[model samples]
Target: MNVLIAMDSFKGALSSERAGKALERGILRTSGHQTTVCSVADGGEGSVHALAACVKGEYKTWQCRDAFHQRITVRTLLFKEGESLCCAVEAADIFGLHNCEVSSATAATASTYGLGELLNQLHGHAIHKVLLFLGGTITTDGGLGVLQGLGIRLYDQMGNVLPDDCNPLFAFDHWDEEAFQTVRKKLGDMKLLVGCDVCAPLYGKEGCVLTYSAQKGANAMQMHKLEQQLHLLEQRSARNLMQEGCGAGGGCAAGLHILGAELTFGYELINRYVRLEQRLHTADLVITGEGQMNHQTLQGKLPIRIAQAAKKEGIPVLAVCGQREVDCIALTTYFQGIFTIQQGIYPLHEALAHTEEYLEETGYQLMRLITMTAGISHTVLKNQKVTIAEELCRKGKTI
Candidate 1:
C-alpha cells in the first residue's frame, strides 16, 4: 500500500519535513510499504519552509526585527512557477507571537514592522508574485507598523509622527499615503496574495480584538482599548472593516488589503503551490498530523484540510498528533482514526523534546496494526470456512 506521510510542523519541536521523516522511519521499520513524506503547512509559522520543500526552492534570509522590535534573521522562499519568479513569506517568522511572551504588554506593543522591512527588500528582485502567509502574529495595530515600515508616516491628532515600534492603532489619526503609493508603484505588476484562514472582520463583536486579543495576552482593559483603537482606525481609513479575513494576523490582512493584496484561504493557497490534492490521488492511505488537534482543527487547520481532501478522493486518513484536545467523534467525519503520540505524562518541555521519538513509535505501531489487519483480511478471503481465531493460530499469531 502506498502511504503518504504529510505532517505539519510540531510547533517549536519539529518541522514538517523532520516530523514526516521521523514517522516515515517508523513506518519503514514496520514494513517496506511504499511511503512518501510530504511537507505541509496552513500558511502560518512554518509555511515558507513547507513551500520551499515542495518546490525545491532556495532560501533567502533577511535581517529584520521581530514582533518586539528585536533584531532577527527571517527566511523567505524563492521559487519559480514556470518562468515567473515567486516568493513565499510567512508573517509569523518575522512578527510571530513566539517572538515574546504572551502578555498584555507584548500584545499592546507587537508590530509588523519587520515584515514590512522584508517586503521593502523585495523591491528589486523582479519577483512576479508574493505569497504572504498571514497567521500566528501578536500585533493588533491593524497593520500600522507594516505601513510605517513601508515608509507611510503615521501621525497623531497633533500631527506628530508616531513611532513604528509600538501599537499605534489608537494614536493613529492619519497617514501620509505618498510613500505607500510609491512602494506600490515600485512593485509594478507583482501580485500580492495574503494567505489567511480566519474570516473574522477587523473590529466588531466577532472581530480580531474581541475574539483573538485575549489569547495574545491582552487583559480586559487592553482588549477594550484595542477594540476602540481598531474601531477608530476603521472609521479613519474608511476601508471595508467587515471584509472576510480582515482580522487575520490582528488586522494585518485588512492593512495589506489597503496595499492591494488579495486575501485567500491560507490552506488553499499553500495547497495550490504544493499540489497536495494531486499527490493524494495516488495514495492508498494518508497519515497527517499537527502539534495539537483541537476544535480549531475543524475550523480548517492543516491536518483537517489534508483529511478533507483525502476523504473526497476516497482515501482513508489517519492522524497522529502530539496531543488530542478535540472530541474524536467530531473529527471522525474527516479522519478514519486519530492517535496521540504521548505515551506517558511529562512536562511540556520534555514532551516537546520527545515528540520525534513518540511520533516514530506511534507510526510503527499504527503500521503494524494495518499490516496485521491486511493479513487477516487476506486470510479470511482465501479460506471462507476458517474462523478468524483459527486463522490467527494457524499463522502462529496471537488472537
Candidate 2:
C-alpha cells in the first residue's frame, strides 16, 4: 500500500515542502508503505517553491521595488520552453514592503502593475495557463494598478488619466479600450486560474476596501475614501460581465477576471495542479496540516480539501496543526483524527514556539498507532485487502 502526505505552509513560516517530504519518508521507512509527498501551496507564500517542484521551473532573482518603492530582489519563477502547465504567482512578491515603511495602508497602494508586467512578459512566450495566488498583499486599490499595466486606461469625466494614487481612486470615470487590444488578443485563449478564498465583493462593509484597508494602515478618512473608489471600480468591472474574486489582492482578481480569468478555491487549484487525487487514491492513509486548525480549515482551506479528497479515496486523513481549536465533533466529519501542537497542556505562545518539535512528535505517534493497529488487525486487514482487490478486479478501479 502507498501513503500520500500533503500539506501547505502559511505565510511567515518555513516551507511545507520539507515537512511533507519528511512525513513521506518517515512513513515509508517505518511501515514499508510506499509514499508520495505532494508539496502544495495556495499561492500565499512559498508558492514559487511549490511551483518549481511541480513544474520543474527555474528561479531568477531581480531587484525590484516593493509597494513603497523600496528596493528588494524579488524571485520570479520561469519555466523551460513548453514545460509550464501554469504560472503560480504570489502577490506579496511585488506588494511586500520593506525599507519604505511599516504597515502604512495609505502608503501601501495595491498596484499589481508589477504582476501585470510579469504576466505581459510571459505572454510573449507560448505558455498560457496562469494561477494567481492571492495573499499577503499590502494594497487595497481594487486592482486598478494591475489593469492599468495591462493597458486598460482609467480616466475622469474631463478625460484626464486618473491620478496614480489611492487618494484619487474615486475619480475613475471610464475605461479606455483601444489600449487593451494587445492584452485582450493575447489572453483571449488563455486560462487565468485565481487561487483565492476571499469571496468578498469590491466595496461596502464586507467588501475588499473597507475590510482590508485598515490592515494596510489606512486611516478612517482613507478607509472611507478607498471604499468609495472600490465601489466605482466594482461597478465598472460588473458592467463588463466579470465578478468573483474581485476582492483578491486588493482587486487583482478583478483585473484578471475582466480579462476572462476563472475563479476556483485556492486549495482546489493547488490539489488539481499538483495531481492530488491520483496520489490520494493510492495512499493507505493521508496526513495534512497547517499553522492552525480552526473553523477556517473547514472553509476551503488546505487541510479540509486534502481530507475530502482522501475520503473520496476511502483513505483516512489525520491532521496535526500548530494551534488546534476546540469542537472535535465538527471536525470529525472532515478528518479521521486531529491533534494540536499544544501537547494536551501548554500556553498558546508556548505551543507555537515549539511547533516543529510537536509536529515531529505527533508524526511519530501517528506512526506508532498505525503500527499497533496493523499488528492488531493483521488477519482482518489481510481478509479485507483480498476482498477489496477482488471487488476492484471485478468492477474496475473507477468506482
Tens digit of lDDT per residue, candidate 2, span 195-227? Answer: 875555555655666665666677777767666
Instruction: Give the poorly placed runs of model 2, Cα more than 4 Å off.
Output: 22-34, 61-64, 80-88, 96-108, 124-129, 156-160, 165-173, 180-183, 186-191, 197-228, 239-244, 325-332, 343-354, 369-399
The candidate maximizing TM-score is: 1
Q: How big is the positional error of residue 106 in model 2, measured in Å on the Cα after superposition?
A: 5.4
Clashing pairs in 1: none
Off by over 4 Å in 1: 177-180, 185-188, 197-199, 204-206, 327-329, 371-399
Q: Please, what is the whole-model Cα lDDT of each candidate in the order they appear?
A: 0.80, 0.62
User: What's the TM-score of each model vs. the native?
Assistant: 0.87, 0.75
Clash number for each model:
0, 3
Residue pairs clashing, model 2:
105-216, 105-217, 110-139
> Which prediction has the highest lDDT against the true structure?
1
